[model samples]
Target: MPKRIPLQRRGRAKPKFRPRTHKSLGKIELPKQENTGIILDLLHDNIKSAPIMKVRFGKDVMLLAATNGSRVGENIMIHKLADLPEGSLVCNVESRPGAGPKLIRSAGGAGRIVGKEGKLTSVLLPSKEIKKIHSECRAIVGRVAGAGMTEKPMLKAGAGFYAMKAKGIIWPRVRATKKNAVDHPFGGGGKTLGKKKTVSRHASPGRKVGSISARRTGKRRGKK
Candidate 1:
């Protein structure tokens, strides 16, 4: 009969492993929403005032509200909030949003919609002027707000308050300044290096405690 051999235990059993998944990492995805409410209001107001509008050149018009009624190839006015009636066309606009109007053809600045006619949309720009825009170019309704001014800055006070609580650090008053040498070297004032006195010359042994000597190592044995 063969001798019964004992099973030798090898290394400790490995723990069951799980591959990391993005779901476990706690990342979240958010859906984008259309920001057209203001545009819709402007269009509704425009249509209510005048269903049929004509755009001319050399006339100054103010956009009273935002809108979406005007299309490419259609004439429109730059009616101001103060003066809605008696608009001009000699200095008016001529191009629509979808139609490829030349940048030089814009009477006003880029993104400005003109409301007059017969006036040359393109101007003889000075040599210093780098941009070439068309006067006839009309921007889509609700598209004329200046850069980033329409959107509100996100409120971070709530998150910041919670973070400060967790870190056990009080939010200091806005005007408070640091006291004395505890501040970093780049900090203000003649408080440079503060009350701590400089070390005297040849105080400690060379390369010993607190010395600025170069590092040296003893010769190794039998390595020549």
Candidate 2:
């Protein structure tokens, strides 16, 4: 009998394939109302690379993604994007008016305010995509902290594995060719994939490993 494919095993959501959510400190979100808060503490979460700031607003407390130059005891203002001036750098931006922070939460990431038009504001994202978001949507000022985290090398396989483990990612990825014929579609073909690697966009998960719905394959030939 053939062993269960990696796709099937992962889809089963077993402990080995599940994200280690127990390690997460808490969800980071903007408060419902605009309020000034003082940072009570800076914390590290096992699942997040960015430092989290615990802030207290009056009697209520909330967690936010720490920004560069942020410090405990510092008073931070939570305001709508429309209230902030143009050319300001921001992070943890809400995609909609009441949506809590759906973008720019990655460590060292920030979105620049290009300009505002009517009820929408344009932001230049870290990926260089210009997205128009609702002006009333809120965000934290400044770039996300933990910059240069990637610049530091792991220097060891164990260190890399532990890092990926914290993020609930499977490390030491196995190539399809290294798998048995029953495991992957491109398996048991030595170095060469016996069949065309490109797959249909509607291919099932078990057979969707390679370049899906590729427009064209092979190296481009210049005008000869």
- Global lDDT scores for all candidate models: 0.27, 0.88
Best prediction by TM-score: 2
Write candidate 2's Cα lDDT for 92-143 as tens digits: 8999977788899888999999999999999999999999999999888899
lDDT of 1 by residue, 82-109 (tens): 1222122122222342232222212122
List where candidate 1 sits over 4 angstroms from the true fold: 1-132, 136-138, 142-186, 190-224
> For candidate 1, which ten residues in a row score worst on lDDT?
28-37
Clash list (residue pairs), candidate 2: none
What TM-score number comes out for model 1? Answer: 0.18
* Alpha-carbon runs more than 4 Å astray in model 2: 198-224
